[model samples]
Target: MQKNPGAKTIEGDLEEALFHAGAVPEQDRGCPKRFDWARSARTDKGVSAVGQVVSGRFYVDPPGLVQRLNSILPPQIRIFGYKRVTASFNAKKFCDRRRYVYLIPVFALDPSCHRDRESVLASLGSENELVKCLECSERGRKVEGIMGKRNFDSKIGLDVGKLESGISSNNQDAGTTEEKIKDFSLGANNGGFDIEKTEEDEVLVQDVNQEEVKAIKKSDFRYGEEERERFNRVLQYYQGTHNFHNFTTRTKAEDPAARRYIISFDAKTTVNVEGIEFVKCEVIGQSFMLHQIRKMIGLAVAIMRNIAPESLIETAFRQDVDINVPMAPEVGLYLDECFFSSYNQKWKDSHEELSMQTYAEEAEDFKMQYIYSHIASTEHKEGVVALWLHSLNYRNYPDLRFINNNVNNDVESLGIEAKDGEK
Candidate 1:
């Protein structure tokens, strides 16, 4: 789901690219449309997908096909491999699950002056130095508190009552499961995801709910082993169905549409060139609403920072509960994979179902070089996550307007487009 402001969708551009490149025939695609095209996910600006699948008729054979498509596509977008699927298959309908990986730099998690609070405070033992650190933290928390309630809907203006009413209802299953999710990590090596690692822990019982937790590893993180354990445990809270109204905009707390099922969430530590450990978090789920994943990570980070209570998660899931969820940067997020087992089972004998393995190895390498590097570079401008955490301890906005507030909460209706197509 690649996007460019003031430009057509990546899907539309791809069709044109393929047609002009001699894949979709000009005649077959008439006013009624010659070939069918469908995609599995939708992404907002600054988002990238490495294994997004789309179904359409192609004119070329399997050999040298990837090279041919890449020749016509832009440098930012690449054509991986293609697989022929059964006629009954629809890319959007047959898809079962979507997986995402959020990459974080270990150094970014550290406070501006030092790796952590104790380290920062210890280096500045004098009374004057202690006061300065507190002052900086106080200022940062002001922004973080504001960001917790900030969202596309609030910025655009939406009716708060209807939004909460819609999501808080019993219907929004988001299709997760009714089972409880558990945290079971073994050691600090796998991206700093150290757990009990006992044989009993390894023998995880497979229930309908456990089956959904797909991601079992993590990425680079800057926190210590203690923080890593807390981070992993916090992920389990998001495993089953929950009211995610606070995570997205323009949705009611009771809205059934607000419920989403998270199958798996895990983390590990990765060391950057400077030797700082960055904990990378991976979450796989049935699907997510707007800004849901980022908020989850943001809240998790705040908890690890000891700025917010883990009880906030429990409150967030309750009906009509208002919780501030600081949003994580989108730069580190990646659409790692999508599953279509429901349809794949029927067609596995024919091929490996629909996948992007053909160019996966190369495409991922290119993403790390071009995409991840740029995200890390731009991060220098402002440490969004750190600033947000600072706000957890303190926030002062006398005139701030939030939908969850009890009194004089104005409901303004405005036209906002919903991109339910991509994740």
Candidate 2:
């Protein structure tokens, strides 16, 4: 249901099919409820969402549901949005996290059209060259600014020492209240004015004191240099909750700017099998501006690639940099997760359920594709092997099938029985 150019046509077809099947009630036959669905920014003609959420009541027979829907739905689209929700539950507000994955194959080619091997090699080299150039251009820039609990500009009015002092005072007040309650309870148990401490009570008191000491000791927290900087920047902006109207994009023409509090920001890196690496930048706030995540990612990518210096992030915050740098593509961005103080457990459970559902759906798709590939290979055995081997060595090595087959008997070594099941 998430936006497709052909959605209106599909909806009409579905309505007609349901009418023919007598699925709708007599009263509702003349008026089917319309639905409003959201589409991704990059959705295109042939592309489709694998896991889109939609909510609506439909009257249909269980036995004929698949048939009726399939008859109306296009081959590229399917009904993957059939979730039930509570009346009070809002999908956007209740969602704690939305994770998206962008997949980029190290090697790819058009399968339908055949090209000369020499041209294919030349194209691959050109792509590599372009990627290298981009990487080099990105690496030369620097970004500057303090992160957590640090002073950005003196004018911003940050007082870290005072904040820490307040936290310490609060801790002392809590401790004093706890001690007074314990003393009061002890006094009540004692007769009139006399106070007596049993050996068991003394031991219990000692254990409790030790535990409190351990807890206090464990509470001593510190941040790494980079982490401290990132945290300070977020806290500086997020501490006093405000409308981030200017920070984010508006969905509706009249919708108010989003109210947000910076929760946290963490940056890390990942290394792939081929020694290629990527920096993973994660920022969490109460709410985000439209495309904010992607923008942040773009900044980070710019910094890591050296296209912008570390100072550039702070400059952007100060509105000093050119705003023309469009946000990074959504494919490489993810909604990592969201945070909620109220109904945290429910939100967590829902996220887990959604994640598991996505995984299962993806697994099923993979399974079907695997089956299809095996079937196709069975019908074209020699061609499949040749294609597979060509893919394996296409990037870095030469095609040495003749050498391998003659010298090491790789065909037999691979457990492929020669014709008549003999090696």
Candidate 3:
């Protein structure tokens, strides 16, 4: 029952609608005076929730209440139906498990979809050459922005002589792509949109270009069984409980909270949305931290693309190593369901079971109309996955490089120095 924070939120909208609907007393609206409002789960900005539940004391009339509230709320926010719970019921504490679904573009998992094969070859060539490629790629991005997008081939106009001379002169002082990624702040908030209403009408989100949009739609954008199997193998790494301190921010490896239990995580199937194909990944876990789900998806993509080795997943779970795991865009993530099995088992005789089954049809319709539609439209227009994959190549992970070297025998040909034991 607090003052609206200007930007629209589900809870904020609910509170306002309840007050206007006479479901809650106007006086009991904020701070100590407000009714206790608890949500089953909280999602970050731009993340949608389909089966989110809330509980609190309200002056509900029980008849026409859902319709009355729907009239006041926005099109995206809806009140399906309400249930009377026990006086001591708390939505947050009583919730046992949460399920989240991530819709990732097939191109993000299919290495063959990447347009910059030449850049990938150059990135693995030598340390200095990697730096040059990153710099040239940055410059090309700026130019692409100014002139709009023409063609991917036209953008790979690198001056070999000038780049070679520059690399020779600055080899000792050249910075890696890792430094550029930090400076550009690509990993912050895992690239989620921050919606703060300003004096001007604007929505802050990741920058997009027509070329990237065209790039995503240009190819068949389909993956074969081999690619699907690889993506699933990468996801399998996150199935068990692990120390995921590196997956999110601020939490240290020593902190007990850093460890999260993932009951299961898998790529369920490929979904065709409009013309683009998406890999539907479903994860069931006790809980997830900020940007945790997105980072999981990001790291999986990194492994699938060969930018990072599969073993890096195991290494990241260890306390000694702190990896800067990239975050996927927030558009595709949504809260699928919340479980209250314990409470239902205990209180079933007296009160109704706290389940979303009654509203399953409504939830699916809502997701199709609002959540899925938004994700598909955003991907088609913004090309969030393609752009994110491009930035990932700039990363120079030590373990990844080591694994690449071990697998490829042409280290000398690529200008990388052989180890003491190697020929």
Candidate 4:
């Protein structure tokens, strides 16, 4: 049986009802009751199920069993209803995909304090630290793991070229030109390259936004060149269908049971409305082993911290490799979403209706609490002003793109000059 953490209370209540109805024995009337012949699938605590299905044989009448179960279930964890499928139907085998959605607050600090004056001043100098700290927090780290696959050593860099290669290999001629066109469009919009043209009378040049250039320059937010290349190598090694046993944490005896699958991972950084920045990583896979995501996030964090050697990722990608690195924290992680080939229309419709109702109620309660908090804090205008000031500084800071570009150019040239000097 698969259990949902969020439904524990309701599950317990239902168990009691089942006991009363003689569906369960007196000794088996508790939350973690064990049935001698049944197998269990364990899931993390606090994880909720939306449309999970389970099957079993019972001596009691099916309709009566279901009705009794529903009667004791809490409104928060209601059973939407169920249907009988073919006798050969297997809930796990028939599942095409599983999706999870995680709601994350964009900015780390209190949203209201962002408008204060003192906050604005502090934000300008402390923005990077704040972002790093927030992301390093337990919840942030956990969410990062949920976003990707990684080696047991906890390395999480993605191989974009490898992903593209896999897709190409599968369909051969599929999406090649279309992918190039999309890439070109995105690159052009992001100012990835410059174009030169000459008119009949004179040469015209497109001007780059100095502020944008500065922002790009100031954003020292990615792996170093050598580190990035090593990461790419690791990704290339893992491309296509290959057993990921070595990349996962498991006992030697379990190696024979390990599986191979395809995975696509992407990472990018974006600035939010509040001027706070974040790194978002998305990973799609046929399936993943235990702790795969956590390990990957841990690797990424290590790379970001300049602690791990870049080649470590490549080594970890090898077959039967034993990567024993600490896994990253889980609080920052979220099972963002799942995908399936198709969904039941009626069930989907009902689920949407129920979700909307729940959200509406929650929204009303939140609004009331917010109003009360605002009124209670009215006298603390000084503190509020400080926070607002911090937010403003974040929004109005001068772009650092020019400085960054100059530094990068100088570094490159310095290397060239040094080589010549050595000669």
My TM-score estimates for the predictions, one after another, are 0.64, 0.38, 0.72, 0.39
> Which of the two, 1 or 3, has more lDDT?
3
Ranking by lDDT: 3, 1, 4, 2
Question: C-alpha displacement of 273 in model 2, angstroms?
Answer: 12
Local distance difference test values of all predictions, in order: 0.51, 0.31, 0.61, 0.32
| Residues 1-423, model 4: lDDT tens digits | 133455433234434554564555566555332432121111243222233333222234433444454455333333333333333333344344433222112222223222333333355665432222111112111111211122122322211110000000000111111110100000000001122322331222223355323322223333435534444443343345555554456534136545545455544332222222333444555555665555554454343333344444444444433445435433223333233333334346432211213233433332223221221122121122222223233223211011221322332332222222222
Q: What is the C-alpha lDDT profile of model 2 across 1-423, one tens digit per residue?
A: 122343433234334544564445566653544321222122222112233233233444444443444445443333322223334443345444333222111111112112224433455546422111110012121111122122233122211111000000000011111010000000000001122433322111122243233322211222345543553453243333444432445432134454445555554333232221223344555555666555554444333322334543333332111222324433323322222235446655653233324334533353233222222222121122112312232232121111222323333442222333323
lDDT of 2 at 139: 19
Model 4 alpha-carbon miss at residue 384, Å: 26
TM-score rank order = 3, 1, 4, 2
Give the number of the best model, judged by TM-score: 3
C-alpha lDDT of residue 151 in model 2: 28
lDDT, candidate 2, equals: 0.31
Please identify model 1 stretches exceeding 4 Å from their true place.
Answer: 2-5, 27-34, 61-63, 107-222, 271-277, 356-360, 381-393, 396-423
RMSD of each: 18.4, 29.4, 15.4, 21.4
In candidate 3, the residue pairs with backbone N, CA or C atoms under 3 Å apart (3 or more residues apart, or in different chains) clash, namely 1-29
Q: Candidate 1's error at 204, in angstroms? A: 57
